[model samples]
Target: MTENPLKAKDEQPFVIDPIADTGAAKWSYFSLTFSLFYFFHIIAKYEQYTNTQLISVFVIYICFIALFFQAIRSTGKAVLKPIIAIVILSAVGAAINPGTNALFGYAAFFSGYYFLRKYAVLLLILNLAAQISSALILDLLSPYYLGPSLACSFSLFVYGIFSQKEYIHSCLQQKKNQQIEQLAAIAERERIARDMHDLLGHSLSSLALKSELAEKLANKQHFEAAKKEISEVASLARQTLSEVRLAVTGLKLQGLSGSLQKLTNELKNMKFDTQCYIDALNLPPMVESTLIILSKEWITNILRHSNGNSVSIAITTDANNVTLSIGDNGKTAKIKPGNGIEGMRSRVAELSGSLDINDDDGVKLTVVIPLLATVRSNVKNKAIVSV
Candidate 1:
């Protein structure tokens, strides 16, 4: 079954592995730094330069701050597009009016948003490219030196690319996990459907058919025989009802062996020599419940209709499927079609398994289940345990 989405195991609450944690931490740090730099830039830009003679410092400072924010934000595809657009727009504005400080300030804000909101390498690259392009296009000196600006921008771009790549990989991993969980959940639901049908349907149908026969006989001359039949049907109904209640109540959290033991006891109390022989096989809660319900209904049928004196049940693991067979040394009459039996057939179909009921000397019911339906490794292992 799928691990609980909202509730994790009590044994280990925080199960995020090192790689996942590292990615999250990296993203957080990137966002925080960008936020701080954005604030610092806003304050710095508003202040009047005390010494406007050395104006290159203003241009260089603004370029670094904007580059820092945009580089971090472009680590993911979601924010990469917007950041790239801003970078291009800023570069164009800078080229048109080379000496304007307003374009530099604007570019820095775009970098900050890209860094904090998304992980996209392209955003960082575009921002640095804009800075380099602007420096070359708006060179105040007669001679232009584009080499230094290009080198600095390229280095920052490379760093942002690596960070973005890691972030994307992490997201892909999480998505895969979620898909696996969803598949598990779908399988579990199918299993439950099959189990309920097998357990409840068979018992009710057998009881109903027997009860009808008893009523018919009562109207005829066989009054004693009719009463006997009616009594058996009544007992079957009561047992089935109890089993249904237990199956529904103990479904989510109960252990497999324990649920089976309860069923065995209930059957024994009703004077059916029901011997439960489960191998050292542990199963998931859902599988256990399904088996328990199936057992209850199967045994009830044997007692009421099969005229079986002793019943033996055996469960074993055969590769991926848990196989169960219930055999009895009782006489079998002509099997009649009923809703209960039909339901059992349907339930088995849901689990993608087969259920066969045979009557030669006595009635034998065999069930084949997939191993994936059960959680085996965690199950408590024990030899033959009887109740």
Candidate 2:
């Protein structure tokens, strides 16, 4: 038979872990032991019952205990069947012995945990009705008996609601953590890919240019010039390999000042006027690395794409933020964001930073990153340790 959609939706699947299950079962059994007093009460009033009645009571108690263990161990939708059986068994056991009415509290607790709010309330009310009807039919109602039974059942049901909410909250938190981990891994992979492209793209282009020059010199029978070109190619290859190694190891051979100087020299070699400024401030390794890469990327873009012969680069820091601004005298009507721009944005965003592109006079890019608490703490700790 097919299950009811409403009932199926209301059920919570159990996680089966050996250690967790063992701990839960241990607590449950400890609590169940308290119910033994009811059995003791029955035995104490032995003179008021026949042998058949005692045997029936003992058999019912044993079966109820077995079902209770089953309910605790059961997983998934199967748990609801055993829980429902538990409720029925508790009602029957109460009819047989009014002292066993406490069993209804167990039923109410499980119902609240396994069922949705409305259904759990319905089950609690039904169990209470069953308890009252059984007590009335058997003429076993007492001021002491009914009040405590109802109160315990309600109290446990409320506890069950709280426990259910806590469990669901924990599950959501776990799922969120997993998603964050997965996203971090994806971002790392993208970062490596971008780094590789940036590192290799310029070097390979230089290699190709030098190789072509060497071939032309050889074709022209200028052995000396060709030899010189080949030597430069070999040196550039070694430098590229070293940079790749540094990228892989997540290290930078030069700090921000040194890297900016190298970039400015490169622009000068290309016959472009370059102005550069760097503030003397402590920077975290990640921020330094990101700025270095972005400087290289922007400089490369300027060399390859810009029409202007002048470029300006500035790095400045305030109390709360560090900013990098790069602009060229190249004329541009509109700015188009491509892979390089996207990569820069991604890198800046990872550090909770922002990137802006403006093209009013020439293409300009600005990156601003906040000195977050952790970064500031690291700077402070470094100063302390250095002192």
Instruction: Give the best candidate by lDDT.
Output: 2
What local distance difference test score does each model get? Answer: 0.56, 0.74
Candidate number of the best TM-score: 2
lDDT of 1 by residue, 69-130 (tens): 44434433433343455456545544433333233333333333224223223344555556
Worst 10 residues of 1 by lDDT: 378-387
Model 1 / residue 144 / CA error / Å: 15
Write down the TM-score for model 1: 0.38
**Shift of residue 146 alpha carbon in model 1, Å:** 6.8
TM-score of every prediction relative to native: 0.38, 0.55
Tens digits of lDDT, candidate 2, 1-387 = 433222224343332211132333455677786577557657667788788888888887887788777766655555566666766776667666667776778877777765667767887888888878867877868865688778988998897777666554544544454566568657866787799998799999999999999999999999999999999999999999978875664434357887788789879999999999889477865687789899899999999989999999999999888999999999976878999999999999999999999999888889999976444431100000000
How large is the C-alpha RMSD of every model relative to the true structure? 17.5, 16.3
**Residue 369 displacement (Å), model 1:** 30
TM-score of 2: 0.55
For candidate 2, which ten residues in a row score worst on lDDT? 378-387
